[model samples]
Target: MGLFALLNRLFHHGPAWLTFLVMGLAAAGLALCSFNLLFLFQANYHLLFTYGAMAAFDGGLLQFIELTAWGYLAIACYVVAEGCLEGLLTRIRRAQL
Candidate 1:
């Protein structure tokens, strides 16, 4: 029963392949950029490494806090827009009926 319930829950969440695909593409792009910065652009490697280390050690929390605020704002805006669209569609359907 638990297994069936879990499967049912998963099935209801919609497909995940597209999300995974996009995430994979983004990871690949980031890897490529890092590879290029570290290898292809050898002249700037030391500067990049220093900055990266600084961000990794010193600015980690600061970066997360700053980026998280922007992320939250973007998500909130998306949710509001989605709700508005859904409400508008619902009203249109009711009017048609």
Candidate 2:
């Protein structure tokens, strides 16, 4: 897809660690929002990041951290696969020349 290509180009030159950092931040932000909404129905309230971090750290809030890890692993695998495929295609084209 065009969007995929665009994103790949944008990130291709950066350190992979940056991508993971951004992903974690994004997940934390979403968790914070989710926690705030979920807390509305309960009598208890906690600090925003505290509740959000619980989603990633605590065993009771939710397993969002595990889910995020899985998602990141999947994306890493895809990038490796794509890179291998591109390399193969380049080799094949060179052979045909």
Candidate 3:
């Protein structure tokens, strides 16, 4: 469906394409960042390669030890919070319907 339709479904329906999409993207972001940080760690500290498995989420020269795993937790929280928010929105919309 189109973007507008998709958004509508997200704000309207409880769980469907939109919810699944959120979950999928969230998972991807988690996996991507996890390995990206791993790459940064190895590259800077140990001078190793991560087989480019982190290209998607790699922050390039923005690597640091502070936000390594925290980023993953943040993404996961966002996904769950978003899913719940969308679910609440759906309930509200359905009630109005």
Candidate 4:
């Protein structure tokens, strides 16, 4: 029936509240990607122009003090970058709705 078709299209493709859920999952996936890359570049890898990662749990927070300021800074920067990307995706879903 036309009525069922209309409802189906609205829920499936047109603006609807459920779109927010899909957007959130997408944001999480993106953030995870960012976290992995950050972990790789700022901490994990050691190849030309790269420094090696420190054992985060070795001595706990106290050991953080031994890191160069840039190393410490990268940790904070990565968190913010990932959070912002998630927020952006959330807003995008709301906008579409």
> Quick one: best lDDT, which candidate?
3
Runs of candidate 2 exceeding 4 Å displacement: 1-62
1-97 in candidate 4: lDDT tens per residue?
9965653443345443554444455455545444445444544333322422334444423333433444555554454445445555656787899
What is the clash count for each candidate, in the order shown?
Answer: 0, 0, 0, 0
Q: Which scores greater on lDDT, model 3 or model 4?
A: 3
Would you give me the overall lDDT of model 4?
A: 0.47
Where is the poorest 10-residue window by lDDT in model 1? 7-16
Decoy 4 TM-score against native: 0.31
> What are the Cα lDDT values of the candidates?
0.47, 0.49, 0.58, 0.47
lDDT (0-100) at residue 65 of candidate 1?
Answer: 56
Each candidate: RMSD to true structure?
14.0, 12.4, 8.9, 13.0
> Which segments of candidate 3 are over 4 A away from where they belong?
1-13, 46-62, 65-74, 77-97
Clashing pairs in 2: none
What tens digits encode model 1's per-residue C-alpha lDDT throughout 10-62? 33332445333433454454444344333433433444466786645665545
- Model 3: how large is the Cα RMSD against the reference? 8.9
Error of 3 at 15 (Å): 3.5
**Residue 52 displacement in candidate 3 (angstroms):** 27
lDDT by residue for model 2 over 29-81, one digit each (tens)? 54544444434424223432456665435543444444455455555655544
**3 Cα displacement, candidate 1 (Å):** 37
